[model samples]
Target: MTTREWAGDAETRQVTEVASERELRELIGEPNDRAANKIRSRLHDLDRQWLARSPFCYLATADAEGRCDVSPKGDPAGFTLVLDDATLAIPDRPGNKRLDGFRNILANPQVGLNYVLPGRSDTLRINGRGRILRDAPFFDDMVVKGNRPRLALLVEIDEVFYHCSKAFLRSQLWQPESWQPDAVPSRARIAKGIEAPDIPLEQLEAHYGAGYADRLYG
Candidate 1:
């Protein structure tokens, strides 16, 4: 069958697969000049500026067993403190206390961070080793709205780089005109599918709202 005919006939189409690094390289070839040269092992002045203006980041971590998790962290701009060229710190705010990220740090110190700023097409990526600290001087410096974070994640930088804008450009992430209307499922509707179908949704929502306002600070 021709390529188009093979695609059209589902029964004859076994998954087109590349099972090894050699096959992968044959398929995609090598990176060009800019792609091969963009990575940096240490933070630079421009990287610091990008991080300082960012209010949000996604943190990726894995436990000793290699179970992985990614969690969102957000606060006011520059909430993440660049302690030096080789170290950074992020405050831990109060939340549901699942501690998935924190627990992973204890078992496996390696972490990956992607910092994003609104309206900015490029993002900063950092790979590091993390440790949880409660040292008074360091933890006390992260006070927000008169509340100090009980813990802070101190990351020793290993690698840092600026990822290009292809992803955001393809998704039109910063274009309000291309956005769809908010159609988020209700908390109650989500809860019903999980573990608690019998409880009233109103009570769950009210409790969540109150906790959001009252326990937001750490």
Candidate 2:
């Protein structure tokens, strides 16, 4: 089929598959349901406290191989620094030498970022075109002691939205007073368990801990 015809055919819905409200909403569930009212247009600016309150985030990217990578980034709330309404910069904190996320960016410029706020019920999701920025852009994010990062990844945001962290609230994510130690695994021990063919996970942990102090903020 021609390109236009193929696109049309894909969008044409069969009338036989009509869905019942109970079946649809029940399947979609409450948390996944659309909000009664939603904001239009992306907010170019970020509220300062959002960055200050966030302790962890996940970076998602897809490479030419069609394999996708999702990596966790964390720090004392505010490791991610927003430069302006149009640009957001993340300090490339050191990790295992794998650099899977960075490598994927070289082959694919698209990225999805989810910034999670600590003890809060809302998170930020952003989709953007990203590029590696150097020199001043990199230096501006430096810490008082760590020096500066070699470079920073600059993301030119296309769209951004806030998600209600209903699940987190239901799970009592931030209620540290009631949290059980067994709920979360110790990073050090968890790292010691994984044994990859190419690189031992324990070795990766050692390298990450050694370099993180110097790479982040510095």
Candidate 3:
């Protein structure tokens, strides 16, 4: 990603940052009734409808020490299993073996999820506790493209709400013209540069090439 310089002069920056809640609230006042009162302890009918159509979400988790990680999870629409009004199960898709977010969940059950749909400006936010399940009766329900997840993350809802579209509007995330997927470096080149200098560039490129998508379920 290209980094841009701050548009303001350095001299105009504030000398002291607003560190306290009082000072922070003074800058951005309290939320309105609609915003503050919209949180629900469990999923509503509409929330269920939303999850049924959402193909992607961001999973946020933190370890016991508060070190955080946010990972993107996606599948065909209705991939999330709504076990009950307060319970949800997300299949563990194949990906890098790092398991950063999963490791965080093992140490700290608390988690946050932001569900998004393509072209939608608003988002669904869920805060809950999570645990990993090696297998469940519902695993059959999570099958996709002839592959069933070996594990899944179960979340017990604590709070659920709809977030405003201010951030989405500001960033124009749904706009294709705003996208710069190659603004940084290609995945293969990046891996060869930082993670595997000894690996041949051709080999890395081929590993991340056209056949990459075929391995999504592998």
Q: How many residue pairs clash in each candidate?
A: 0, 4, 0
lDDT of each: 0.87, 0.71, 0.93
Off by over 4 Å in 2: 1-41, 44-46, 183-188, 196-218
Q: What tens digits encode model 2's per-residue C-alpha lDDT throughout 1-218?
A: 11222235459533434257776676676653456434323444354567667878999998988799999987777877777775778866555569888889899999888898766778888789878766663466555355466666788878777777787878887888868887865555565555443666667667566675665543
Predicted structure with the largest TM-score when compared to the true one: 3
Residue-wise C-alpha lDDT for candidate 3, range 6-49, written one tens digit per residue: 33654443345456788778889999889889999999999999
Encode model 1's per-residue lDDT on 1-218: one tens digit a residue. Answer: 11332455446564455567877778789889988877777789998898889999999999999999999999889999988899999999888799999999999999999999999899999999999987657676678898788889999999888888999999999999998645766665677668677888887677555575665673
For lDDT, candidate 1 versus 3, the one ahead is 3
TM-score of model 1 relative to the true fold?
A: 0.85
Q: List the residue pairs that clash in candidate 1.
A: none
Q: What's the CA error at residue 1 for candidate 2, in Å?
A: 24
Instruction: Please give the distance, in angstroms, between residue 138's alpha carbon in candidate 3 and its true position after superposition.
Output: 0.3
Backbone clash pairs for candidate 2 read: 146-218, 147-218, 148-218, 149-218
